[model samples]
Target: MKNVSRVFYITLALVIITVIFGAAFPAQFEGITGSIKSYVATTFGWYYLLLMSALVIVAVSISISPWGKIRLGKDGEKPEFSLPTWTAMLFSAGMGIGLVFYGAAEPLFHYLSDSPTAETGSGKAFKEGLVYAYYHWGIHVWAMYGVTALALAFFQFRKGEPGLISTTLKPLFGDKMNGPLGTLIDVLAVFATVFGVATSLGFGAVQINGGLSHLFDVEVGFTSQFFIITVVTLLFLVSAWTGLSKGIKYLSNTNLVLSVVLLVLVLIIGPTILILNMFTETFGMYIQNFIEISFRTAPLESDNRSWLDSWTIFYWAWWVSWAPFVGMFIARVSRGRTIRQFLTGVLTIPTLLVSIWFAVFGTTSGNIQNNGTELTQYATELVLFNMFDQLPLSLILSLLAIVLIGSFFITSADSATFVLGMQSTNGSLLPANRIKIVWGLAQSSVALILLYVGGLQAIQNTIIAAALPFSFVMILMVIALFKALNEEHKKMEAEEEKKQNS
Candidate 1:
């Protein structure tokens, strides 16, 4: 509370107001958010596609260019965290609970319920389904995250600037970034972060309830989920107040180990051979059709366009909305690596790992469906748990998955608390604990309200709508980063030439 910035007050006020309105008039809140989601998908589908593609290209270019050698910190400084630890943090911040929630259900849906292009329930749909899941959770999301994270890391560690998003624009905006415009930018970022984290929290609570209700005799409604969120909220708040290396690092490493164990067991138990084959085929298809799908809008085909609206457009917006929180958190954990190493690790490692996770789960689920089990008839949150039920050691696997979700839930919320606190107080490395607690409550309240209003759908609609403004901010961030990187590279060249002359 001592070092809190005005951004905190304004953002808090905005979020409180939103929660009040949502709580007071749940129907209107849901209706307005749904309209915004539809409008964004229909009106700016092309813009999202292009913006995401450019971000990926920009991230790739930075990794391969001469500027890649620029260290995120002052020259000669070593990274604060070890390689494995850093990677774990990156993996955790990147996509913890989501992979669990949508890991299998997405592909199963595409193959059975709504094929992207192929006839529903056809072989082509089965194959194409995995490819689209790979596309959505693939390099595009990480690239957008990498570039934004790179910008923040370069400016904060190397230039010794504050870690706020607006500070990255100094090369473009100069002193104006320290003014009202900058405050607006930071507030918007905090607002987006709130929703992004809240959505994940909502998903985590619901899915945890889904797992419990499936495994135990628990009920499957807001009452159970409400308690789940309450318990996890207190747990994560404790972890959040603990310093990063102590709390987050341990939880994330645990998440990685649990994730690997679950993946291996499912691969062996579900459909081992088919998982590998699906991986090989879809990896190739994803690469081959990557460019076409990157720019595809399908204006002539209403069916395809509608699919794009629901899946692709929504995904693009989700990633952009998530970019700030992911970017800032990754930047915090990625302080000492060079630009090249940073971007390479960010763009490649997570993308590959996520693709494999999806392949294993997606392939296994597809196999189950093809075998005559109508898994799609179940709720989305219960799909993965039910899939586990069909495998060996079903009870143990279900328990492990619940623990994994719980850990990921805590880790994600932990990261969010710190990011929110940092952004709120002008990027303070050690934001006051009270401020974090307030934010923790704020985030949890938002998630609970969303659950009350419209559950998972309300979460999705809110995110799609929240992402639109931040997408423009992301564009500005890329421009600012490029300008700064180019100017710095020129200075490096001039100094190198001067050294030769001397």
Candidate 2:
């Protein structure tokens, strides 16, 4: 409490007001959010697409440039975690819930419901569906995250700045970043972090509820999701109280194991050849069409534009909104790594791994539908469960999925609590347990409230609305990071020249 700044109180009050509004009048809340979401999507869809695509280019360019030699911390400081542990943590925190939630459903949606460039249910649509799935969750997503995390790590570690979003801009703003404007920036980051994470939590809860309904006939609705959020919130809150190194670290490792087990099982049991083929083919096509897809605004085609707004633009915003939390968390553990190493790992490894995941799940879902399972009849949340129901070891796979989602649910919420605590406090490496508890509950409550209002629709609306401001912040961060990196490189070069002259 003593370390808590006005950011904490301010963000807390804002979240409380949102909760009251959402609770007192759910219909009005959803309606307003929907209107704003629509406006942002229609007006700024091109901006989101361009900004996210450019981030990929910037992140990749920086990693291979001369400045890549610079370490995140003081010279020769060793990394806190090992390679395997680091990758696990990256993949877990970066794409954990999503890999389980949308891995199957996204492809199915694109193929059966609304293909990006092909007629629904056609062969071209099938291939393009998988390709676009790779597009949405591919290197671009990691690029946005990698750029954000790279900046935070560079500033917080090498420059000895606080691990807050606003602090990353001090290179551009100087002392001004410590003013009310800075508080506003941090608040926006915290606000985005809260809502963005809550969206994932909402997905996790719904999928868990869906799995429950499949396995045990548990009712699938708001009540089940509410209960799911409450129980999982308590689990993760306890984990948060245990501290990050032990709780989140170990849980991340556990998530990695479970995720691998589940992925491998799906590969083995559910259309192995199709998954392998799709993984090989789609990844290639994804690369080939990457440029066209990245810049595509669908300006001439209303249907394609509608699909873009619903999927691609939404993903761009969601990733941007989610970046503060994911970026900060990655930055914290990334101390002492070279900029090249951090960016390389963050951009490439997780992207490849998550692509493999999407391939397995997406292709398998497609195969099931092609085999006449009529999977489209299932709700999005239940698609994975029903898809598993038609596979070998159906019960075991379903149960493992439920457990995996639950594990991801806990780890994500736990990590969010830690990040929120640090953001609210003075970017403490180890924030107070009580502060974490407050954030833990607040996140779950927001997720619950949104789910109650309009299910996934409400969550998506809030994400696009919340992400618009932060996208501008991300642009400024990239500029500031480059200026600082260039300045430091020049300083280092001049010092070397002086030493040689002496």
Q: How many residue pairs clash in each candidate?
A: 0, 0
The residue pairs in collision within model 2 are: none
Candidate 1 off by > 4 Å: none
For candidate 1, the TM-score is: 0.99
Off by over 4 Å in 2: none
Candidate 1: tens digits of C-alpha lDDT, residues 1-502? 6778889999999999999999999999999999999898989999999999998899999899999999999888888888888888888877889999999999989998988789998888988988999899989999999999999999999899999999988888899999998999999899998998899899999999999999887999999999999999999999988878888999989999999999999988888888899899989999999999788887886557888988999888877878888999999998889999899998888889898999999999989877887899899999998888788899999999999999999998888889889998888988888888899999999999999999988888999999889888888888999888888889889999999999
Best by lDDT: 2
In the order shown, the candidates' Cα RMSDs to the true structure are: 1.0, 1.0
lDDT of 2 by residue, 196-277 (tens): 9999999999999999999999999999898899899989998999997899999999999998999999999888887888
* Model 1 lDDT, residue 268, Cα: 85
Q: In model 1, how large is the Cα lDDT of residue 174?
A: 92
